[model samples]
Target chain A: MATITTTRDGVPRAASQPTRGRPDRGFGTIGGYIGRTVLALFFAFPIIFMFASSLKPDNQIFADLSSLRAFLPVGDISMDNYKAVFDTVPAWRFLANSIGVSLLTVVLGVLVNSLAAFALSRMRWRGRGFVLAAIIATLVVPFETFALPLLWWVNKLPWLVMQNGQPMWTLGWLDSYQVQIIPFIANAFSIYLYYSYFSTIPKELDEAARIDGASWFRIYRSIIMPLAGPATATVAILTFLPAWNQFLWPLMAVQSENLRPVMVGVQYFFQLDVAWGPMMAYASLITIPVLALFLSFQRAFIGSIASSGVKG
Target chain B: MSRFMIERRGTAVLAGVATAALALSACGVASTSSGGSAGELTLWTHNAGNPAELGVINQIVADYNASQSKYTVKLQAFPQESYNDAVVAAATAKKLPCVLDADAPTVPNWAYAGYLTPLDLPQDLVSKQLKSTLGNYQGKLYSIGMYDAALGLFARKSALEAAGVRIATVDNPWTAQEFADALAKIKADGKYQYAFDLGTGDSGTEWWTYGYSPFLQSFGGDLIDRNGYKTAGGVLNGDAALKWASWFQGLVKNGYTPAKSSTDAFADFVNGKSAMVWSGIWHSGNLSKLGADGIVMPPPDFGNGPKIGGGSWQWAVSSTCGEKAAAMDYITFSLNKKYLAEMAEKQNVIPATEEAAAMVDGWQPGGAKRFFLDESAKYAMIRPPTPGYPFLTTTFAKAAQDIIAGGDPKTILDQAVSDIDADLKANNHYGF
Candidate 1:
């Protein structure tokens, strides 16, 4: 066994380490690897089962539930369910709508929320604390309590439309893409997240920029935003998820199938005889994109959570 | 950080917001309308994902639009699961389409809430429809359906024969005792995972009432007293209902059925996991996979004779529809025997009229699907035609779920009755 020694910094150091060519194979490290692998598998089993079941027939899916075959694509498998998904719903159209809506919401949300956060955190203004408190307070009011009233309000709003090559005003925001994206752009939780992260940046940076005759917007755009990558990533993901998974609002607000998102498409398979296989296929199809997005932003998401003291 | 750079950035931000606003404004489609231009009538149906039914509906609209120059009918389809929420939301916004299809039990509530208008189709044409297909609340017809559905006990002939269970018929359904014996015999065979699949895995409250309430009614209990529609006190918690609660729970306790079966019980039955499945008419198509071995039997006569939940999706004109006469004209035109037969054939539901049934392949007299029509005509019991049905259904479903999960049936039933009565009283007996 290599002896461990304390360094001047009070950190443990392996004084006489094992051969440099090979890594340590200690039991603790091995146990840690086992634990991590188990945790990864525990979280991955549902996704694995979903993907596996999506390729099999409905009867075969039930038949394999008793054993490990459920999570493995080992039985008679095919892309038939995926094909059926296209037949059952306009899968590509719904996917495209969701992606566009989610991306736009993320971009707009980050810009709008970060600006609100910067004003609350860096700029000196009267009633700033009350404004921030009010924004945070709205988080406690459940979306469902105001969903109906919001629906009524959106239906009465006026929109600009083109008729016969002339601009005309129309009433109601029903059956539109903007109705889905705009209402979700100014999220309260996102504003709070950006505020917390912005508060951590040293005030001296803003002071130095100000001493050099920088405007507030200039300071926000140049100095503050560049250092808010983690916060931006966190807010982008937070906004994207709800935007992608919107079902009830879109179902009520949007009447056209072409305007619907992927989440609303899931209901298409819930016919009299629910197409379970096709539903799983649609789920897997929609989930893969979100999984990829989260994976790409995994590091920054965790860093933001840690640095900003956000629980999740 | 200079003044010019700051001004440029500010200008860019303002320009970006303006562009985004313009883009968003341009994204809006023409607002949905019940009646537009005095000649266009908008109709909505809950058939978005169902191509077969939607195809027929689209064909009807196309034919109607082609057959007339005065008005054009436009169809918008929504998925069935969330269709109600959409309609309710639209109703709240006072933007309901000219015509929409609503589930049967909801027609009363919709009419009571002033969401539906009394249909103005020809009385002679309406008389030809199945009585259960008519949505009548407070002595006025508010809706009509092209097709209705039925329920049956689907099983394999081979399994029944091997288990020595006598095949049941519409005339002489198995009594409660005989049905219990059959389940016991099937379980004793030990060849299947469960002797019966009650489809309890369907967690929808509507399913609970539609699929199981018939058994409660057969046991001489009901969700509410029909005479007054004011309360569920005696009927829902009475002795007959107690017996139903016990027997329903007993099926699971006796291991005749899983407490919570697979989500797709018909799939499990088709895979030989369950010897029998209590399912709806929608599942009859999949029975063809069993070839001649598959059989459908009437539900057992628990005590009040065999019963099945009735009523299905029915069409109605929204109260806010500006073109009520025009919408009624289109609705009446679509009710022709030709369209009805097409719906019955393509959707595999029981035709709403004998004349329509005569036109369909398997729905004519002595046809393979004729039994479903006979069952619907004889044994079908439409849920209480009262505006309180929504609340009643939810209460009964919760009570039934609790009983299935092994709660004391009497306590749960009593609580359900109390809750239901309180709601009825609160709403002034739902305008009785």
Candidate 2:
């Protein structure tokens, strides 16, 4: 429904209904546009500099620093840095490993965290709150405070491996992808987010599903999970970011070059006479996946960040 | 009800399977074999990303493996930035490779911690090496590098001449007064943004100690009292140290140098932002790009003599290694004159031996960078050789940083001396 109005010129105007969550297009809207454009440029500047510097030679990268030329594709520009980056590190291998590790972490993290959250939020089990509180308490302790102890435990932990056509037990999870993925799968923050989201879904739906002879797990799978799409996406993203940008843990845990993530590959160019252009090119290459993910899920990503209180 | 029973039974079966799998894995863990077995030796290097150094080490490994079948030497290269942490972590896990490289200043600390075993190289090979290249801990040689690095005052002869400053030479480095007069003259000339660049922007802890501690020593103050390796009381905060600190702070106060230099000090020098730069020999290439006007001179004398920090990364055998003989064999094989020259050429550092210097092109007599070799041989003083050197470096770096940022020199140095003494006392004088 719309309201009709007559202007001074005697033409009828149809005033559209104000939609919920939409701000009126007033003078403040113009200010918002300007503010947004400035913010956009502020964030885009670093990426632009990286890409522009990636195209230029090392000396020119420094030479153009004093002027607007730094962010522009001016001067002698080429893909020489790309070639050098390819020569220096196993870019494809590192990227593939990172993608594999990050994807597995996200999928597993979502499943594990959601299940834990469902148990805590939906179930009426005893000591469930205590368990939740304990998990949440871990959020205060940084990973670095326990990294060494975790390393020792991981080294001592056992894993099943197929060796010489036989299932064999292996001691030390070092130099393997499982070590990188498994340790990060059970994140506390992801569990908390899932639990918070799960609590919003009506328990009557669960009651009705149970009355229809649906098991708790079945209800979780067929109803609640599908309803928690935004939370799942948020957890997947949150899980993907840290797992993708992992440096210290992977550096210490994985010894084989084939298991290294792209973040660690950044250090390959940081030698005596660091190849600045190549390093920038490599950074630009690795940043593509994250940018693509953000662009595809921009709305949900923004909402998640806003709700989760994550600044950047 | 039947379906619920079926699902519950299935869950039990799945849990059983998982338990069995974990048990099998546990059995395998129990039977894990000892490390360094099967005639294989693992050697770790801080050369990952550095293709030049990695290539040199790889060639040495290839030669060593081919020359003998007694043991196969496998090389694992880690990036230099994270290399020390990795080594420390590996040591904690008792998973250190048979052979590894340590930065020279940290060698004594590693040796004291039992992470490295003493080297037993032949007397002649040891004698041929530069004194700084040898990692001596409690009079035992534990590690040795293929090359060493020297720091110098990089200048443009034309810039100095225009400012009416005498060109400093190896035999006649600028004295304290002469250096000050030259900086003042250059600053008064107003031809450059600043008279000197002391590489202030690179605040890496090692750079602070490596670049500035030598100045402290030249002022007759050491990071620690070398006689007992017990204290820095008289040495670091003494009258000499205060003089060094005042002189260091005066440069920034008088505007002879910037309080914070550009990140790439050498780049600033080449851009003519500064007339001179206190930098390492690695910038020789960029300096050479200035043509014949480029000059590298020894650090200015601050009463005692001009000085530069000595030592670089050197190879050692881990104490936990079961293949010490094989590790030593590889280390010996890797230290050939040819490899040394190749490493120095690739890294643009000074070759550790006279023979290797002759073998390298730019290291020859009267070559462009021959002065660095001469300075390293003459003026380079190895950092305190006690296991406490790590704590000493960090403490000194903090104090010097504070002094440069306008903290009282006496108070800052006194605090540094207190911290160093406390750490040494905590570690029983670091096995002095």
Candidate 3:
């Protein structure tokens, strides 16, 4: 076993490590900071520009494009665009709809996909390998290729609805919240992610739980699921982003203004004139929840990615 | 351990039973059909974000509903950008509303796809509307608009006078050489960033087809042979099209117009950044800011006469509409002169009928906006009214972009022609 030593900086260093191979402390650290800052700015400029331009009028947004002023709230700025956004579309309703849809998708997706994955990863099943392979194969197919066919299929599906205070059934899920959420819940990539993560968990925990009179589900629920923090966070984030940014599916599926999500609201500004200010304001408005979500789950999300070897 | 195994097996059995019960319950629910109930007629409009236009549509619906005791119209507004997609999806699901508004160019395609039904309105009412406003495919009138849009070259009179360029009129618009000289003189004056704004910053395929294809038509080349509507063979890749492509590419090379303009080209021209802007009549409202200096001129004739793409959004009755007569009644009632004028005034488009135009303030005879009406009457050429127009427009827009990007005119046009021909052949000439 390798021994660890505490350096003057309070960082643990391996006893077998050579100091010569380490990077220089002063210039290298400063250079790294500079490079990181440049990369950060490169990634952040578009968002900053969107936020800043949302405050400015249309012409000024174009006029400042040649200068650094484009990314700064400097000239003729106001909350007019935000006010216009409200008047143009029911922004709050769309935001709320998106929040509800994304949360339900994440929660339900976590349950269904994790259950499927748990069965594949832990249970001794006759066709588990083939099942996993089929699920993984679906990941290679794009959503757009089958979007129309899915739309047709969903229209043929029956749903239970409340009518006149009584439960009744309705054909076709178009222009409804369930149309947006239910179809997207059983994501293949999400199941695969959970499968990979669940496989890493020790089988001893399951055996111990079984000996203690726990059922298979109890083992999955009490042992495996409790330890799936990073995987859950990863799946939640991945599922949430697509649900929040659903444009085509919702556009095709839902028609009622009351059922529209924030992403579809972006189209409200693309009128004959293309209201750039209100559009940017709406974009900035919608991007906040996603940013908050990512920031909140940043650590767990990164851990999941690193451990599971998923690049995205 | 035996008790533990038995207990685990019992739990699994219970879980399976519960799931089966849930599935059975789900499958046992009574099913009902979708879409509007008996007398409720649904109307969809591409005016969700456009409050002014949407207000007019809502008012029409309200009046129509109040005017009838037999039927009630319910309005659903969608954003214009995604309106077509929504309609297409709804059509695919067989859930299209009773009445809907479709862009003029798409009427033929929709009609051919059996999405729309021919109108049953009186011949007098149909004939009263401008020819371009009537969305006729073959001989059947499928849709009609309350107003139409026309394109014009908006210029500042002071800039034109300073550049020594003759003011172009509908009757005697500038020739190809004269237009080129005007661009050169304006560029030499150095008073603006570019001599003309073609509104190229708009990245939509429809804009490219509507805004630029007329230039090709003026150069004596068409997207397809209007005679048969079967192929783009010689018409799109011929010598005339080659000339049009080269001249269009030259506009960017000569720095006469920005290859990619700002999103609002008229705004740039208004801000003194350009000498002129080629845009639709929608921008006519802001031309008043230029005071007496503003001039809306006809497009220059390039060998052929000046041509502009015609038509605007029009109302149609869906084929799936259970109440076609009621839908048509609502449509016809909404085309009143008062509503048309109101739409023209609020939306700043040319009223579709002469009587309607006479009611609008600026569209009357000798009115400031009469030029657009005159231009539309004389020069507007409707895009080929065919089921294959969607593919044709997209193909033409792509080819135009490639030409503007310095691709060889002959190669790009030929390839475009081949692609269009292949599509036409594949669609069996789209029931021509």
Which of the CAPRI classes, incorrect, acceptable, medium or high, describes model 1? acceptable
Q: After superposition, how far is residue B75 of candidate 3 from its true place, in Å?
A: 0.8
Task: Return the TM-score for candidate 2, rounded to 2 decimals.
Answer: 0.94
Winner by DockQ between candidate 3 and candidate 2: 3
lDDT tens readout by residue for model 3, A132-202? 99999999999999999999999988777776766666788888999999999999999999998888666
* Residues A65-119, model 1: lDDT tens digits: 8899999997889999999998889999999999999999999999999999999
Per-model TM-score, in order, reads: 0.93, 0.94, 0.94
Best by TM-score: 2
Ranking by lDDT: 3, 1, 2
- Name the regions of candidate 2 deviating beyond 4 angstroms: A1-21, A305-312, B2-36
Chain A accuracy as TM-score for every candidate: 0.91, 0.91, 0.92
Off by over 4 Å in 1: A1-25, B1-37
Residue B190 Cα positional deviation in candidate 2, in Å, after optimal superposition: 1.4
* Per-residue lDDT of A191 in model 3: 95
As for lDDT, the candidate ahead, 1 or 2, is 1
